[model samples]
Target: MAIPSKTIKVFEELLESPQNRLVEQAVESGRIPIGYSCSFVPEALLMADKLFPLRLHAPGLAGTELADNYLSCFVCSYTRGLLEFAMDGRYDLLKGWVFVPSCAHMQRLYDNLEYLQKPDFNHILDVPRKVNNDTLLWMTEELQMLADKLAHHFGADMSDVSLRKAMEQWNDFASVVQSIGDLRKKPNPPINGAEFHQIVMASLASPKDLILPYILDFKKEIEQREGIKNSRARLMLVGGHLHDPEFIRVIESQGCVVVADRFCTGTIPGFKTIDINNDSPYKILAEYTFAKTLCPRMMEDFDRRLNTIIDTVKEYNADGVVLEIIKFCDLWGVDAMPLVSALRDNGIPVLRLEREYCLGGEGQLRTRVQAFIESMGK
Candidate 1:
């Protein structure tokens, strides 16, 4: 299915442009632009502060020599790119930085930012490495502290009324992504794999207020259109630190329809929401985020994470699954083989690809994905 020009334009301006339209629009409107590294940073909290919760990304970064001065070359390329951008004055527009943990590189990135050049505001959030009732209490305390810090730092609204309103808007944002994501499950999805991925990338790259209504409108467009997809097999993508359009395009170019995905950048924690009915939204946010985030950083949680992949395979009716991993990214790296084995054990074909942090490695990936799809012979 061809993407609507209007929707395509939305991403082209955000993803392909030299400057971030969302950040530009936020700055021009006199709103604070708060950049964050991990999904654990609550958008609802940022929106409550009237700040644009810009998910920090190093789109189209050419090289990482500058960052290599401070970070070892062994780190994930995505982290290297982020540090390079920061040192090169790329994040000068951001007023604050919020970092949460799932990997060691990000933790060091915050330290490097503090040493080289620090933003006006800096916050490091703590999430438990385990899942239990005690985790809820710990996260509650941490979120409450974060709320207080943000209120003091930005001098913006943190009232119950403001918090509730932010949750409503965030829930609406989730609804729009969920509606579009649901389309991928159709036997002949109305949207192509790369097209839907662009939609997901646009959500993180742009302001939620602008992207929300735009996608809600686009949802109606896809609903009324007829799909024309005839692929060799159904594929599901699962991994981390991936936002490259070429990654999916190359796979699709090989006669595979990417039916579903689970990743930090794609959709996992990104699709989830807290209980808005709770009187204390902070506690709700803490509990929901702690429970739902299934990164490999959370040790001994492999069963839950594997179950999620299996469930996605079943739910999307995927014929095979691909796990995309960035080399040396300890967070997802360790799980690649286990996931491949577990999924294959369940009678699902699995392919694991170790890729670059950026878009340079698609030639090799295309060959493998093509072979994988051809083997299915659907």
Candidate 2:
């Protein structure tokens, strides 16, 4: 189905604009905005503290010389692009920064960002390697400690009432996003992969207050439309942080319908919500974030992660699995080949594509993707 033009317009406004209008307005109104990138940063905590949690994105960031000087040329492009965005003065409004360790590159970016004196109030939350009762206890205490620090730094109220309210709101947003994802599970899916990617990426770039209404409206439009049953092959895409929708667009353009994904930017982990009823909200956040996450960094849970991908492939009736690894991402680079072997052994066709973080190299990606689609078609 074709998503509503209005929905596409909304996405264009968020993606094409240099800054998020809602975030920019929030900062201009004397509210402090805290910047975060990784999923490990509990956005509910930031909102509960009365801080605007701006999800950091490096929109339109090309190659960078300034960022390259600090980090090696071998670093992941996403981190380097973000560093360039900050150095280029696009992120001056962010009062504080939160760093969650997905890899070594992010840690180095945090360290160098501190040295540069950008976003002076810095925090690092050490989430454990695996999920457990002990992990939740450890993380909740750590969250409480960070809450104290934020309260002191920003002079904002971090009350239980505020936390409950934020949890309710974030949970509502998650419900809406999950509904959108569930649409893809349908035989003739109402929405295509590229449009869905745009919506999710736009949500990351903008606040839920502004983003939710548009998505809800988009959902209604999607429900009223016809399903796309003409695509040649159904595919499941798996990868690390994928913000740009062009990769999905490329796959879709090659007559493959990407009906399932395990992407950081999409619904593998980010779309699920913490159940907020009669629970310590921080503990709920801790459990949901780590327990449901499918990151390659969570080495101990590879079986669980692999099972999730396999289940998605079966559930969606996918013809193939695309292991989309970023070029310099050490974690996924090691992960892709093994996952390819595993999926192929289970009677699933597999394609491993090395990708740049930004929208570059689509021509090369498209040629390879087209060949994969033809292989699946046969």
Candidate 3:
């Protein structure tokens, strides 16, 4: 499934023009529009119902004032930026919003949008924590309930055939993404970290049909390029909102390849797939919510998180870890010391970089990352 070059060009163009008009067209054409926070939401069901499932990225408007009313002054910049975008009516095209209870801040944001601001259609999906039979049954029911709601709201019945079709399409997208991830496992990965980040970000922002082809093409491009002759130290990136290509570029150029990660924008979203056959989607969601690897702000499981990191480092044979702490992101920042301690205990070095979701600090960040990588050589 090599993606074509033409497909890559089209995807790039679509990203450049992420306008309301495009989303509006999808809605006006009788497709229901739904927005989701995390990538765990199943796109197949949405497609089956003739709806547009859009991953909410930037709201396209400033959220400073709106966010100030709800969140604290020291919250993650990504949260504030998104709130500002929503406040400015950039998400006017959204008929419904799906909030996967990943973090407290995101849950709070969902509450505000659904209850306070009042979007046309709103649903808070409760993701389960642990993966088990009980959780699967519960999740299936939740998906059905969501399907029923959409059927009623859109004045269309959701058929079994459509559901199955949607499931297949969603699965196809997942498979493509998984292939991309597998590529990273290779010793001389054809794709660079920055390019890979861009591809993933593009997939998040657009539909699978639009992004899949581009990814395939990008994979082909990588295969054609000369592979890395000397392997660099492997590093696992941990943090939230790492959609910036420049951040990846800075880190990769410092002689370290990000082989694995647990970031909000990275592995976390792809780790779980929605089981549409659950007896209760809400309960399944709830289980995922509770079982999810809690961040510093969410739970007091630093040891557990540390163990998870250690396991990933060992699994990926990583030489070190990089924690991209968003500036003033209380959760990650607060957990920094313990996370560092845990990594050090396992004889794996770690690097902490604070960022504001901008490229302005790249020069200094690169220097620090280079130093970290240099130490790995010794």
lDDT of each model, Cα atoms only? 0.80, 0.81, 0.66
| The best candidate in terms of TM-score | 1
Give the root-mean-square deviation of each candidate in angstroms.
Answer: 1.6, 1.7, 4.5
Residue runs of model 3 more than 4 Å from their true location after superposition: 1-29, 39-47, 59-70, 114-117, 128-144, 156-161, 230-232, 268-308, 328-337
Give candidate 1 misplaced runs (Cα > 4 Å): 1-4, 17-19
Q: Rank the candidates by TM-score, best first.
A: 1, 2, 3
Candidate 2 regions exceeding 4 Å error are: 1-4
TM-score of predicted structure 3: 0.79
lDDT of 3 by residue, 251-302 (tens): 8776667777677667533534445463343443344443443455444456
Backbone clashes under 3 angstroms, per model: 0, 0, 31
Residue 165 lDDT, candidate 1, scale 0-100? 88
Winner of 1 and 3 under lDDT: 1
Candidate 3 structure lDDT? 0.66
- Give the per-residue lDDT digits (tens) of candidate 1, residues 302-361: 999899888988888899988888888887877887778888888989888888777776
True lDDT of residue 97, candidate 1: 87
Instruction: Give the higher-lDDT candidate: 2 or 3.
Output: 2
Best model number under lDDT: 2
Worst 10 residues of 2 by lDDT: 1-10
| Worst ten in a row by lDDT for model 1 | 10-19
Clashing pairs in 1: none
